[model samples]
Target: MSHQRYEADLRRLFAGFPTGVSVVTAQAPDGTPWGMTCTSLCSVALDPPTLLVCLRAGSPTLGAVLDSGSLSVNLLHQHARSAAELFGSGAADRFDRVPWVPARHGGPHLVEAAHTIADCTVTTEQAVGDHTVVMARATQVTSLRRPIPLLYGMRRYGSWAEDMENGFLSYDFIS
Candidate 1:
């Protein structure tokens, strides 16, 4: 298959698997903040509390993360769609438009948009295709609010709805 064909096919395949939204942030050596919206987050292990996130290769955010050896993973809430788009847009002034503070590990924490924040230290990284897979060890995890996750799949955004009768979470579509 051609690269384009397989790429589009893989995208369609993953679109059937919904995932939560997150923003990975890092502080450059010169104090510049860099971040991007990411959905390729996975838990690696619970013994050491490790997680992995995939970021576009050569992005400033990825560079900062590798340079500083530290990062903050902000798990965005349902109300944080604007932040998700802002960070995903590769806008130069993304930080200026959002309210954030330095996390305990020195990475930027989205104050208003995140339901949880995980401060981590870079453990390992590997290049794969057009992205870099970063494995980090969680040093701290702060739960700022109840989890009403922002979801992305099917080429759009969505959220979780409470099943009032069963008190369970269910998928709710949004434009």
Candidate 2:
């Protein structure tokens, strides 16, 4: 397929795949907080607790995260869409609108996020066409909220709602 066709098809294909939302955060040398909401976070290993995140090329936070040698992955809950938008935006003072605290390892952690995974360093970075994939070693993990995760799919956000039992065998059995 042509490059344009491939791009369009990829977008359509990805839209069908539901992904959990997260915000990757770090602080610059001048104590300025930086972050970006991403669905590109993936687990790379279990024994070593490693993960990967893809950041767009030329993002200010990307270079700062590389320089800081660490980052915190803040998992957004189903109710944190506003926080997600704030971090995803290109506007300054994104942190001003969100409640957060510094991670034990020194990166910014969203105080109300579902959870946080603190990575110590970028073990490797591969430059893709328009983004760079960063592999990091997780040093810590913390849960700030319940396990209800925020999901993105088909260009929308949705949550799993439990149906009450209506004398149905399947519902009663599960309940």
Candidate 3:
């Protein structure tokens, strides 16, 4: 298979595995905010509360993150599709469209859109392919609401559903 075909196949395969959506945000030295919607976030370790996020190489958000040595991973809620789209659209005024406030550390926290915010300090970064894998230690976690995580998969959006019988939420892909 050609390289392009292989890449497409890999993306399709990963699309089958739905995951929560998040916005990785950082602030530049001049107080400018930068952010991008990201699904490539994962918990790396528990002992020190480590997490990782992959950001596109040369992205302004990535640059600001590196320069500031901090970031905030805002976990979007089910009602935050618009914010997700806005962040991903590369709009110059993306931050203006969303309601947010400065976090305790790192970048601003999406007030209405995110159910949780993890304020982290950058630990390490490695360039990989067209993206940079950023590792950070979460120094603070603020839970705004219960987890009705916004999910992305199969090129669609979904959310968790309450399973009353089990008294828990389950992956109920609406799309």
Number of backbone clashes in candidate 3: 0
The full ranking of all candidates by TM-score, starting with the best, is 1, 3, 2
Model 1 per-residue lDDT tens digits across residues 1-175: 9999999999899998999999999999999999999999999999899999999999999999999999999999999999999999999999999999987684899989999999999999999999999999999998999988999999899998998999898888888
Candidate 3 lDDT over 51-96, as tens digits, reads 9999999999999999999999999999999999999999999988
RMSD in Å for candidate 1, one decimal?
A: 1.2
TM-score of each: 0.96, 0.87, 0.94
lDDT score of residue 128 within candidate 2: 100
Against the hidden true structure, what lDDT does model 3 obtain? 0.94
TM-score of structure candidate 1:
0.96
Model 1 per-residue lDDT at 148: 89
List the pairs of residues colliding in candidate 3. Answer: none
Residue pairs that clash (backbone atoms under 3 angstroms), model 1:
none
Candidate 1 steric clashes: 0
Q: Cα deviation in Å at residue 81, candidate 1?
A: 0.1
Best by TM-score: 1
TM-score of 2: 0.87
Regions of model 2 farther than 4 Å from truth: 1-3, 164-175
